[model samples]
Target: MVVMKKMMIGFLLVLMALLSGCQMSEVYDTSVNLCIIVANRKNQPDFSDSETLNTSLKNVIDSYGKVQIIVPDGAPYIQGTYSIEEPAKRMSSRKAADWRDIQISSMYNILTTTRAQTPEVDLLSAISLAGRWLDDREGEKQLLIVDNGLSTVGLLDFTKNLIRVDANTIVEYLEEKEAIPSLSGIDVTWVGLGDTADSQQSLTPVNRKNLECIWNSICIAGGADSVTFRGDAPSTGNNSESLPEVTPIDIIAEEPMEVPAKQSRTWWLGEEKCQFLPDSAEFVDIDATKSLLQPIVEAVANEDLILGFCGTTARAPGATEQGCQELSLQRALAVEKLMLEMGMDMRRIGVTLGRGYNHPYYINDRNEDGTLNEQIASANRSVIIFSLDSEVAEKLLKE
Candidate 1:
């Protein structure tokens, strides 16, 4: 009787262990909630890419507890969700197969409907809305973004000056505008970025790098746990095959220029004959100034170059000496601010000075009455970028 009791106890223990193992396995099979946001802004959508993404998505959703497709162009962000059944008795093989088929069919329908119904894509709004939808949702969350990642409309327009802005500056702007979304605990995957035909114009190598950097920073700033990019490589097209492979401009200082100790070399901005507006430091032609500054910016970034801004102004009618000096200082400070905003390091910029009506470039071109020459007075009312390193002349020549 004692042996029989021991045998029974051992049998019960084994059975309990088996049941516990089964429960652990079931827990491991828990489902996830997947959110997909598609950008449908291209003139011609790539159906092949769409199909590839859909297949991958279906594979992911097969094990998901729930799935939501967020199509931004629609009035309501959620386009559809996979049908989920209530927890009950274990399903038979036949029933499980039927459920999988139904879910896949539903996913296909959702994709088709989204592609057909979406008219224009507003990327920022879509992300904001999707983030709101996912907030406080249950289950493991995943966000899959399908778009070129370009914001064509609203405050974050890439077509405007936004692209030229630095990544940190862009993030600050978005935050100030209350445009960033809360994406904490979400894993984001960006697809189809820089892949569409329409993106050819805007998706150069540098631009693509900038876009990825900006998006990555934005996602991190918005509290995303992880961000991944799975997009087509940026292509310059077959026409690029016929084009010549241009060499990179060498901006290094080949031979340092000779200069006296404590003296500087000056690089002027405007025509020798033109003058800046009186009491104003703003760039008269921003585009032209940008073009000229590009090389200087690059040289400074690539080499050991230190830059200083000296603002000088011609004596304006009734403008006191102090006022002129103050205006000149403001102009020099303005140039420094512009360069800093354009992504230059602040450490490289030094010594902003204002010299009012002093050391004119064309002193001999004065009017017959010994007053400043109007034709060449504009030259004096300018910002002079100088470098203490005499080597800058050689570096500028290489550029």
Candidate 2:
């Protein structure tokens, strides 16, 4: 009895030790917010196919039991709960060649064949969709991308490979890849399988707008009914280098144009005797009057800007005041034309009206000479330049 007791005690101690070791070695269920980046392989012919690409994506998504897929634009964002068991299995060796190529092909075929959107357009759409995934949540998240090329991480370069692997393995691979350049305006980790996470998050604000325009043009070309197809199409209108020449401020003023800028500052141009009415009474030169506002117009063009044309209204004896109002409107139209000619994108422009002597810039309309100073005359009337509020501009632009 004493010998049996000793043996049982030893067995229990060994079993407990083994169990503790197993517990310590096990990877716990890591609940992490993951940013899944899907980049279109620019080299693939069918890289934009939505159906094919989505199918493959669905397969990858299905393999993970704890993940919830999130599609911001068309679908909700996915929340993933990963378990250690999933990563234990290995992907088939045959399908491991160029995971990026396969992904690109799958996506391209879907969009091209079914959606009828072009590769460039399709790519942009996919990128946009990937970006939208973040709309649902805020704060820190792990960015997992399956694409080609590399991005910087705080001046470091991290390149990675993509194959059939579990999410945890993918995370491990990125950490070991290289020091990466910091992605400005965004905080996320980047991981690539066969290539670096090349979906550049460092795009300049201006470049982003241009990229969107390029995709829009592609949509027009592709005849894709879905806006998604339109968002990513290749730019046909202007290349980055071929951007329209920014007209000088004087030139813009001379042409009577308006422009939009990305920044915000109030620019008010004052001329006292600014002839509120056109020089010709019989025929008001609306366009000609607008020509005088070239400086403001050009400035707006150089900077992402907006324009508000205000004119003082004094009820003259006859149709003079009315004539002046009409002339002001004419000037506004003229400015719009010059803006277009100067290569300022019309999409950035906005128009507003300031009528009458209701709000005058200067207290005294008359100059020291006591005579109506031509400069001081319209000085009471002026145009102000400012930033286009996104919501207001968007509404007007849509209208």
TM-scores of the candidates are 0.48, 0.27
Per-residue error (Å), model 1, residue 390: 25
* Model 2 segments more than 4 A misplaced: 1-262, 269-303, 313-324, 360-362, 366-375, 389-399
- Flag regions of model 1 displaced more than 4 Å: 1-30, 39-41, 47-64, 74-76, 86-98, 116-120, 198-202, 232-399
Worst 10 residues of 1 by lDDT: 242-251
- Show the lowest summed lDDT stretch of 10 residues, model 2: 244-253
Clash count list over all predictions: 3, 66
Write the residue-wise lDDT of candidate 2 on 1-399 in tens digits: 999999999999987765543311223243333344442332212223334334334343333212222221112223232321332333433333344245436434532323211222122233334444443434323333333222211111221211112434433443465322222222332222122112323333333343334333333333322322112223222122311121111101123356644555554544331333343222234455456556655676676556543333333334355675665455444445555675666765566553444333334545465556554455555444445664433332332
TM-score of 2: 0.27
Let me know the TM-score candidate 1 reaches against the reference structure: 0.48
- Among the numbered candidates, top TM-score falls to 1
Task: Estimate every model's Cα lDDT from 0 to 1.
Answer: 0.63, 0.36
lDDT for 241 (candidate 1): 26
> Model 1 misses residue 224 by how many Å?
0.3
